[model samples]
Target: MFDVAGLWHGFQIAATPVNLMWGLIGCALGTAVGVLPGLGPAATIALLLPISMKMGSPVTAIILMSGIFYGAMYGGSTTSILLKIPGEAASVVTCIDGYEMAKSGRAGAALGVAAIGSFIAGTIGLIGLTMMAPPLAEAALKFGPSEYFSLTVLGLLLATYLTGESALKGLTMAIVGLILGCMGLDPLSGAVRFDFGVADLQSNLDFVTLAMGLFGVGEILYSLEKSGTASILTTRIENVFPKLADLTRSGWSMVRGSVIGFLVGILPGGGAVLSSLISYAVEKKASKHPEEFGHGAIEGVAGPESANNAAASSSFIPLLTLGIPGNASTAMIFAALLIHGITPGPFLLKEHADVFWGVVASMYIGNVMLLILNLPLIGIWVQLLRVPYSFLAPLIMVLTLVGVYSVNNNVFDIWVMLVMGVFGYVARKLKFDLGPLLLAFVLGPIMERSLRQALLMSNGDGSVFFTRPISGSLMAIAIAFVLYNLWAARKKNRAARAVASSEAAK
Candidate 1:
C-alpha cells in the first residue's frame, strides 16, 4: 500500500548532508542522556521540543527527534550492562543478564550483540511500519466521529491495563488527566469551566507546560530525592565483537523479539519496557536450558535488546498514521506535529507525504548510524556516566527554564512549569503512574472533540456509538476488556481469601 516512488523521494531528502548531520547530533545527545540514570526519551524530547520548532521544516525537526528516540534505545543498554542500573524502564530486564555478562568479562560482547540486535529489530520494525501504517491509515479514513471516539476509548483501556501493577491506579491517573484537560475553555460552548480566574487557564494549559514540568522537572526532583550512592564497574575486557556461536544461537531470538516488539508497540500503553519483559519471558520459556538465563546467557541479551528497539520504532505507527500516540514519547511527537501547524490524521500520508516518508526513511539511516556508532564508540558512551549528577542537574534545570521561556517569553508559563513539576513529583511519590496520565492528557482533547461531533451528527442520539458497525465493534471490545479485568481481580481476591481461611483452620 506504500507509494514506492514517494518513499524514494523521501530518501533523497533524508540522505542530505545537513539532515545526516542533524541525525548524528541527535544520536550523540540521545546516547549521552540514555546512558544517564533517571533521564528518558520522553523527557529528553520534551526538553528538545523548543529547539525542534526552530528548525526550518517539519521534516527536518521530526528527523532529528526520531534520531534521539532510537538512539536512546541503542544507548540504554550501556548502563544496564556496565553499572547494573537501567537507563530507563525498558533496560531493566537487560540488567539481569547483561550485567552478569559484564561481570564475567563479556561486557564488550554483550554490548556488541545488543547493538546488532537493536539494528536488526529496528529494521524489522521499520519494514512493519512501512507496510502496515499506510493500510491502517487508509482504514482509519473511513472512521466517523463515533468510530474515532471508540478507538480512543479502547486506547485508554489498553493503556491502563498494560501499565503499573494496579489497574485502579492507571484509571485514577487517566481520570486526573481528563480533569486537567477540562481546565481550559470548553471546545463546544467556549465557556470557561475550571480556569479559577487565571487568564492562562482560559487559554488552557499548553502541552509543553505539562510535559516538561511533569516528565522533565518532576523526574529530576524525584531523582534528587533518591540520589543514592553510585557504584562503579571496575571489570572489563577488550574484544567488542560476538563469537560466531553467539550469533548463531541469538539469531532466532532476535527475529522473535523483533516480531513481538513490533506487535506490542502498536498497542496502547505498550512500549519498550513491556516488550523487553515479554521477550525475556518468552526466551526463558522457549530455551531448552532456561536455567542458564541469569548467568550471562547470550539469548537474554539479544532478545530484550532487540525487542526494546523494535518497540521504540513501531510505537511511531499510531501517531504517524491516526494521530493517536501509543506511548508518552509518541504523544510528544504528536504534539510536535501539531505545533508545527501540521495536524496528523488518516490524511497525513496524502497531505504531507514528504514529512511522513522522510521520517521513515531517516529511521533507516539513523539505525545504521546508531549501529556503527554504538559498536566503535562504545567506550565513549560508557564514559558519559562519569559526569557528576550535580553538574548535570543544574544544566537540565537551566535548559528547562530556557525552554519554557522560549515558548512565548512568558513568565507565567515558567511558573506553570514549576507548579506542574511539583504536582508530578507528588504524584510519583504517591504511586501514581504518569504514563497513563500524560497520554490521557494529550488524547483527552481529541476524544472530547470526537464525542461532541458524534453527538451533533446523531442529533444527541447516544446510541450512535453502539449502532455504527465499526464503532459498535470497538465498544464491544472495550466492554469485554472491562469484564475481563473485573473477573481477574475477583479471582485474585477469592484466592487470597481462601488462603486466609486455610491459615485460620490450621
Candidate 2:
C-alpha cells in the first residue's frame, strides 16, 4: 500500500517557502548552464557543491541540486533546437530535427513542445519512483558482495551498448578507465597497485577532477578545434507557443518517451543520454513520415526532450534506495546525502522517511517550477545563443579550472584536468565517443571493490560467480551481448565487402 501519510508529511517539508525558493534558484542556474556551451549538469553541480554545503539541511541542499540536475536536461534541448549546438551528449538527437524545425520557423513550437513534454515526463517519472523505490530498496538489502559484483558487471555491459559505434572500442576504453581507477590504494590489502612511487596518487584519483578534466576542459579544446567560431542562431522569434494540432501530435510521443526513459534510467550506468537517443530512434521509426525526421519533425523534439527529463528524474531511484548512483549527477546527490550524515540504501527509507519523501515531493514542485521558468523564457534562451564563441570559450576554460581546483583546492587536479582535456580532444578527433569512458571511470572502483569482496567470499573459486541464480543469469546475458555484437560486426563487414566487389565488377 502507498503511504499517503508519509507523502503528506513530505509535502509539508517540500512546500516550505525556503525550499521552494532554493528549488527555483537551482532551476534558473541549471537553465543558464544548459544554455551555455561546454557546461553540463555534472560541471554545474560540482561548481555549486561547496555553496550547497553551506545550506542548513541536507534535504534542502539536495532538493536544490536535484532541481539543477533535471532542469539542465530540460534546458539542454533549447540550444540543440535553436542553434544545432548540443548542450550535452543527451541533446545530440535533438539537434537533427530540432534545428531543422527552427530553420523552418517553428522554433517556438519546438521549444514549447520540449518544455511541456519535459514537465509531463518528469511528473510521471516521479510517480514511478515513488511507487517502485520502496520495494527496490527492500530487494537491495538482500544483495551480497557477489550480487553487487555481478550488478556492476551488468552496468559495464550496458555502458558498452551505449557507446554508439563499436563495442570493442567501448570495451577497450572501459578497461583503460578501470586501470586508471586502480592507480592508487588497494582497498582490501591497502597496497598501492600502480601509484609508481607518487605520493600524490596515494589516495587515488578524484572523480570530480577527472570528470571536470574529461568533460569540461576536453569539451572546450574540442570546440576550439572547429574551423569557424561559435555561431549563434540569429533567427527572429516568432510563434512562441505551440498550435493545438502540434500538441495533439506530440502528446502520445511524450507519453511513450516518458515510459521508455523511466525504464532505461532505472538501469545502472544508463541515463538521459541513452534515453534521449533511444527515444529519438523510436519516434523516427514509428512516425508516419520518417523522411521528415531530419527536417523539422515535431515528434523528434518532443520525444527526446521528454525522455531525457524522465531519465534524469528516474536516475534518483537507485541513488536514494540502493546507494548506487545511476549517473554522475546522482553520484553528487549521493555525496550530498553523505555530507548530511544520512547514508542512503535499504535503510534510507526506514531511517529517513522525511528526507526521502521530501525529496520526492520536491520533484513535483520542481517540475511545476521548471515549466513556469522555461516557457516564457524561451526567447531569452534563444537570444543567449547569439553570444560569440570567442567570449564564451574563455569563460568556459576559466570556469573549468575554478571548478576543478575548488573540489579539493589542489593544483594537481588542475593539471589532471588539462591532460584529460587534451585526451578528450584527441578522442573526439578520432571519432571515439566519451560516454563509455566516463561510465567506466565512475563505476570502476565499485566494480573493483565488489569483485574483490566476491572473490574473498568465494574462497578464490571462480566458479562461484555462476553458482547464484542472479549472478549466473547476469553473466549469461553479458555473454549473449558479446556474441551478438560480434555476429553483427561480422555481418556488417561481409555486406561492405560484397558492395565493394559489386563496384569492382561494374
Candidate 3:
C-alpha cells in the first residue's frame, strides 16, 4: 500500500519554485547528453557532483540529479531513430527497428511511440516504487552469484534472436564479444590477459568508445559507400505522432516492458541497458510477426524505450532502500548523498523522509515534463533526416570522435574507435550482425564474475547452479528456450528442403 499522506508531503516539497526550476534544468541537460553520442548520465552526474555540494539542500540537489537520470532515458531514442547512432548504451536495441522506421519515413511514429511509451513506463515504474520498494529490494537481495550467473546465461542465449538468421553467426559473435570482454586484467587475479603489449589495453576497452565506433562511425562509413544522400528523404514525413494502428500494436508491448523493466531493475547489475535488451528480446519473441522485428517494427521502438525508462526509475530502489547503487549513475547519486551528510539505507525513510519522498514526487513531474519536451523535439530531430549524407557524414564523424575521446580523455581510445569502426564496416559488408557482439560484451564480465563466485562458494561444484532453487529455475528456463529454438530451426530447415525437392520433381 502507498502512503498517501507521505506522498502528499512529498509533492509539497517537489512543487516549490526553486526545486521545479532545477528539475527543468536537469531535464534539459539530460536531453542534450542523450542526443549526443558517447556522453552518458553517469559521467554527467559525476561532473556535477561538486556543484551539487554547494546547493546546501540535499532534497533540491537530488531532485535535479534524479531528473537528469530519467530524462536521458526519454531523450536517448532520438539519435537511435533518426541517425542509427545509439545515444546511450541502453538505446542500442532501439537502433535496430527504429532506424528502419526512419528509412521508411515512419520516424515520427517511432519517436512518438518511444516518447509516449517512456512516459507510460515511467509512471508505472514510479507507482511500483512507491508501493513495493521495500519488498522488491529484499527480493533483489536474494539474487546471489549463482542466480546472477544463471540470469546472464539466459540473457546470452536470448542474444541469438537479436541477429542474423544463422544461430552459428550469432553464437560466434557472442564468443568473440566474450573474448573482447576479457581483453583487460582478470577480475579475480590482477594479471593481464590479452593486452597485446599496449598500456591502454590493460585498462578494459571503453564501452562508449566501442558503441560510438560500431554505430556512429560505422554507419557513416557504410553510408559513404552505399548511398551518397539520406535515404529517409525518399519517403516524406507523414505525421508527428503515432497513428491509431501503431498505438494499438504497441499498447500491450509498453505494459509488458514496464513490468519487465521494473522487475529486472530491482536486481543488482540489472540496469537500464540489460532491461532494454531483455525487453527487446521479449517483444521479438512475443510478436505474432516475428520476421518483422529487425525491419521497422513499432513494437521494437516502443518496448525497449519504455523498458529503459522504467528501469531508470526503478533502479533507484536499491540506492534508496538498500544503500547499494545498482549502476554507475546511481553510484554517483550515492556519492552525492554522502557528500550532503545523508546516508542512504534501511533507516533512510525514517531519518530522511523528505529526500526519499521528494525525489519520488519529482520523478512523476519529470516524466510529464520529458514527454512534453520530447514530443515537440521529434519534428526538429526528424529534420536532420533531410540533410544529405555527404554533408552530414563529416559532422557525424567529428561528433563520434569527440564523444569517444570525451569519455576518458584518451587519444588511444580514438585510435581504437577508428579500428573498431573499420571492423564494423567490414562486418556489415559481410552480413554479420553487431547486436549480439555488443550484448555479449556487456554481459560477459558479469557472467564470468558470477560464475567464478558461485563456483568458489560451492567448493568448485559445477552442479551448484542446478542445486539452488532460483538458479535452478532460471537455468531450466534457459535450457527449454534453447531446445525450443533448435527445434524451430530444424523444422524450418526440413520445410525448406521439402520445397526444394518438390521443385526438382516439377
Q: How close is candidate 1 to the true structure, as a TM-score?
A: 0.98
By TM-score rank, best first, the candidates go 1, 2, 3
Listed in order, each prediction's TM-score against the native is 0.98, 0.91, 0.63
Per-residue alpha-carbon lDDT of model 3 for 1-506, expressed as tens digits?
78888788889999999989999888877876676555567656644654676797999999888888888888789888877888777899999999899898788888889999999999999998898765654565668889878876775666554335567777787788788888898888888988889889998876666656666666668767756443443444457578899999999999999999898777645768888999999999999999999999999999999999999989888678756555656756776787788976556777898998899999999888888888876555445445555665687677677666666678998999899889878887887766667666656777789999999999999999998998999899889988998899899999999999999999
Query: Model 2, residue 6: what's the lDDT?
Result: 76
Q: Which has the better TM-score: candidate 1, or candidate 2?
A: 1
> Which pairs, if any, clash in model 2?
none
lDDT of 1 by residue, 1-506 (tens): 76788779889989889888898887877777788888898899899988888888888888888888888888899999988899877889999999999999899889999999999999999999998989988999999999989999999888988977789999999988877887788888899988888887788788887899999899989888866546668876467788898899999999989999999999888888899999999999989889999998989999999999999999988888888897888888888898899988899999998899989999999999998889988888777778878778879988988998898788898999999899989988988888888889988888999999999999999999999999999999999999999999999999999999999999
Candidate 2 residue runs with Cα over 4 Å from true position: 53-56, 227-230, 332-344
Name the candidate that leads on TM-score.
Answer: 1
RMSD of every candidate to native, in Å, equals: 1.3, 2.6, 7.7
C-alpha lDDT of candidate 2 relative to the true structure: 0.81
Top lDDT: which candidate number?
1
Worst 10 residues of 3 by lDDT: 228-237
Each prediction's total of clashing residue pairs, residues at least 3 apart in sequence or on different chains, is: 0, 0, 0
